[model samples]
Structures are given as structure tokens and as C-alpha cells.
Target: MIEVKNVSMSFRISQDRIQSIKEYLVALIKGKLKYKDFWALRDVSFSVHPGEVLGIIGHNGAGKSTVLKVISGILKPTSGSVSVHGNIVPMLELGSGFDFDLTGRENIFLNGAILGYSRKFLNEKYDDIVAFSELGEFIEMPIRNYSSGMLMRLAFSIATVVNPEILIVDEILAVGDESFQRKSRQRMMELMSGGTTVLFVSHSLEQIREMCDRVLWLDHGQVKMIGEAQEVCDAYQI
Candidate 1:
């Protein structure tokens, strides 16, 4: 289960670009540092039950990604509270944890460890990850030489290896080739059917209507509406 109650997140952004650390230091010491408080989320409240699929939809800057990051423990809210019970696997910004200088074989362990898997676990699952990525002999090469698709495929392969208790995905389904996209979708469906609670953020209304049980619409940084997928989607369309 996932519960987010009156969660609010804020950041203090510099009003002026200082251009250099020396300039920044000068401004800081001179009490000339201009700043503004940007609230990414404001009094946002929602909950997801075990095995439920909830879709978050909004325009750019509507705080969709910020809220996800908060729930994933990537950011702490300025106020309010978030409670989650389960093993969470976040698929936001695929390959965000990879080292381009590292070979694909080396990065599997590196990225796997970032995802909370131990050395022993990664060692055991190494072959399966390589096979799923279909990188074959290329896995030995530095990932810096890999195409964008190759990089994302390797990251996706390593991330979805475990049956997570809670899955957090952010518009990552369109990975790799068409065949691979279909395969990834099937894998997601398998996880959903296996009773994994999911928090999915996507711009595709069709995907939300088809795959989600409920939808939450965010306007600016607040909850504009939340209801059945079709209902919220239709309301959003209008």
C-alpha cells in the first residue's frame, strides 16, 4: 500500500544565473543573492491499495514527476507525510544510474547494486539480464559506445528482473524497438496480474484508460480531479 497525505514539496531556485562560482560567492557574501520559492507540489493527497494501478496525468510542470520522486524517496517533501509499505522499484529516467565508461557487463552489477540488489544476487542473475537485453557480445564493450536504445534496453532488463511489491514507472514503456516494446508491455501486464501495486505516470490517455483502474489529474501542483480512469480521462479531454 502507498499513502501520500497533504504532501508539499518546495525548492529555492536562484533568480539570477551567477555564471561562475566566484560570482556566486560574491553575491552570497554581499547579500545580493536573489531567490524564489517554487512549489512543485501543494497539499497533494492520494492513496494506492495493494495490487491497484493508478495513473497520474498532467501537462508539463504539473508536478507529476516531482510527486513520483517524493514517493520513491528521491526527494523529501517540505511538509506533510508519505507512507509506503512494500519493496519499491522505480523506473524513472532509465539508465540514470549507469556509468557510460563501464562495460555493459560491469554496469549490470553497478546499476543492480543501485537498485538495492546485492553482489550475490546480481552474480546469479547476470546471465538472465544479458540474455534479456539481447546485447550478446556487445555486452563486453564500454556502454559509452552503445546506441541510446542499447543503453536503455540494458537498464530496463536489469530493473525489471525482480518481482517488486510496488512499481513506480514514468513514461518508460516506449523503450527499444517495437518488438521489445511489446515484450516490455507484456512483462508489465504480468507484474500487474501478479498483484504488484503500481503508480504509473504517462501522457498517453489511451494507455491510462486501458491499463489503469483509476486516474489522478493534476493542474499546476494540486489535485484537480481523481476518479475512475475513463471518467477522469474524459473530464481531462473536455
Candidate 2:
């Protein structure tokens, strides 16, 4: 289960900058400084029960990603609190945990380690990961040389293999070709069948309707609606 209470996040940006070190010193002496504040999320609250697939939809800069970031513990909420129960596997940005300089084989181990998998566990699952990625011989080469699709494939394979109690997917299936998209969808369904709670964020209403049990609409950093997938989508369209 996941519970979010009155969550809010804000970012501060410097509005005025010093031209040089001397100017910075003078500004400090004069006590003249400027900044601007932007709130990405405000009083956002929601919950996900076990074995639920919750889809989130919103326009650009509507705090969809910000909400996911807070859930994943990447960014701390400036106000309120988010509490998650169980192991969480966040597939937010593809290849975000990988080391570009390392080989695909090496990165597999590195990523697994970051997810708390031991070297022995990774070694046992190595073949499954390699087969899912379909990089074949390229798996031995450095990940920097792999195409974006290849990197995404590898990342997805590793993330889904462990069957985490909670899965957070953010716009990952939007990449790759039609066939890969189908495979990704199938993998997600398999995870759902295992009773994993899934928090899915995507722009494709069709995909959300087909895959999610419920949908939540977020607009301007607030929950606009939540209900059955089609019902919320219909309300959102209105």
C-alpha cells in the first residue's frame, strides 16, 4: 500500500546573478539578491492498495513526473508526507541507473546491485536478462555504444525481472517500436498477475484504458478526478 498526504514541492531559481566574482562579493556586501519560486505540486494526495493498477494522466508540467519522483523518494516533498509499504521498483527514466562506461554485461550487475541484488543473484538471472534485452553479441560491448532502444530494453528487462511488490512506470513504453511495445505491455501484465501494485504514468489514454484498473487525472498539481479507467478518461475529456 502507498499513502500520500498533503504533499507539496517547490523549486527556487535564482533570478539575478553576479557578473563576476567581484560583483558577487559586492552583491553580498550590498545584500542584494533575487530569486523566484515555482510550485510543482500542491496538496497532492492519493493511495494505492495492493494488486491495484493506477494510471496517472496529465499535460506537460502538470506534476505527473513530480508526483512519481516523490513516490520514488528521488525528490523530497517540501510539505506533507508519502509513505510506501513494501519493496518498490521504479522504472521512471530508462537506463537512469546504468553506467555508460560499463559494458552491458557489467551494467546488468551494477544495476542489480543498486536494486539490492547480490552478485550471486544477478549471475543466476543473467541469461534471462540478456535474452529479454535481445542485444545478442552487443551485450558484451559498452552501453554507451548501444542505441536508445537497446538501453531501454535492457533497463526494462532488469527492472521487471525481480517482481517487486510495487512497480512505478513513467512513460517508458512510449519508446521503442511496435513489437517492443507489445512485449513491454505483456511484461507489465505478467507483473500485475503476480499481485504487484502498479503506478503507471502515461499519455496514451487507450493504453491506460486497456491496462489499468483505475485512472487518476491530475491538473495543475491537484487531483482532478479518480474512478474507473474509462469514466475518468471521459470526465477528463469533458
Candidate 3:
């Protein structure tokens, strides 16, 4: 289960200073700062049960990604609390955990470790990851040499193979070709059938209708509606 209670987040911007002495004095005495307060999320609360597929829909800059970040524990809420049970695999930004200077094979180990997999676990699944990525010869090459699509493929493959209890996907399906997309969608279906909870964030309404059991519509960091996928999508269209 996952519960988000009255969560909100904000950021502070600091002014630039020229002199070191002046900077130190300002830091000590004045400490003048301005807050933009983007309010990526504000008093938003929701809950997801095990094996539930919850789709988040919103316009650009509607705090969709922010909610995912908060749920994934990558960003702390300025106010309120978010509690999640069981392990989570967040496929938010592709290649987020990779080292550009390292080879793709090396980055696989790094990413798998970040996902809490043991070396033995990764070793057993290494071939599956490489095969899914379809970057056979390129796997040994540095990730920096690979294209953006290749990087996304490698990252997505690693993240999904872990079979986390809670999966959070954010626009990662937009990567790769038609065949890869089909395979990915099939993999997601398999996970859902296995009773894994999924939180999906995507702009594709059709895909949401096909994959998600429920949908939440958000606007300006607030929930506009939450219910059946068809109903929320209809409301979102208007």
C-alpha cells in the first residue's frame, strides 16, 4: 500500500554575490533569499492498494512528474508525508542511474545495485537485460557511445527485470521502436497479472485506457478527478 497525505513542495533560489567577504557577511547576517515557490504539488493526497494500476493524467507542467518523484522518495515534500509499503522501481527518467563514462555493461551493474539487487542476482539476469536492450555488440561499448534510444533501452530493461512490488513509470514508453514498445507493453501486462501495483504517468490517453484500471486527473498540482479511467479521460478531454 502507498499513502500520500497533504504533500507539498517548494524551492528556494539564492542570489549571486561577487566578493567572498560580502558573500560570507550576507550568509551570516542578511541571508537574503527569495523563494519562487513553484508549488509543484500542494495538499495532494491519494492511496493505492496492492495490485492496483493507477494512471496519472495532466497537462504539461501539471506536477505529474513531481508526484512521481515524491512517491519514489527522490524529492522530499515541503509539507505532509508520503508512506509506501514494499519495494518500488521507478522508471521516471531513462538512464537516470547510468554513468556516461562507463560501459553499458558496467552501468548495468551500477544501476542494478541502485535498485537493491545483489551482484549474484544481477549476474544471473545480465544476459536477459542485454538481450532485451538489443545492443548486443554495443553492450561492451561505453554508454556515451550509444544513442539516446539505446541508453533508454538498457535502463528500462534493467529496471523492469527487478520485478519490484510497486512500479512507477513516467513517459518511458515513448522511447524505442514499435516492436520494442509491444514487448514492453506485454511485459507490463505480465507484471500486472502477477499482482504488482503500478503507477503510470503518460500523455497517451489510449494507452492509459488500455492498461490502467483507474485514472487521476491533476491540474496545477491539485486533483481534478479520480475514478474510472474512461471517466477521468473524458473529463480530461474537456
Off by over 4 Å in 3: 13-33
lDDT of 1 by residue, 152-195 (tens): 89999998888889999999887899998988788877877788
Prediction 1 TM-score vs. true: 0.93
In model 2, which range of ten residues has the least summed lDDT? 11-20
Cα deviation of 164, candidate 1, in Å? 0.7
Where is the poorest 10-residue window by lDDT in model 1?
184-193
Best by lDDT: 1
Q: In TM-score terms, which candidate is top?
A: 1
The TM-score of predicted model 3 comes to 0.88
Clashes of 1: 0
Give the residue spans of candidate 1 off by over 4 A. 18-31
Ranking by TM-score: 1, 2, 3
TM-score, one value per model: 0.93, 0.90, 0.88
lDDT of 2 by residue, 1-238 (tens): 9999999999876567557999777777887766678888889888888999999998888899999989989999999999999988888876767999999999999998887677887889999999987889999999999898898899888877788899898877745678888887788788877888999999988889888999988988888888899999988777
Of 1 and 2, the candidate ahead on TM-score is 1
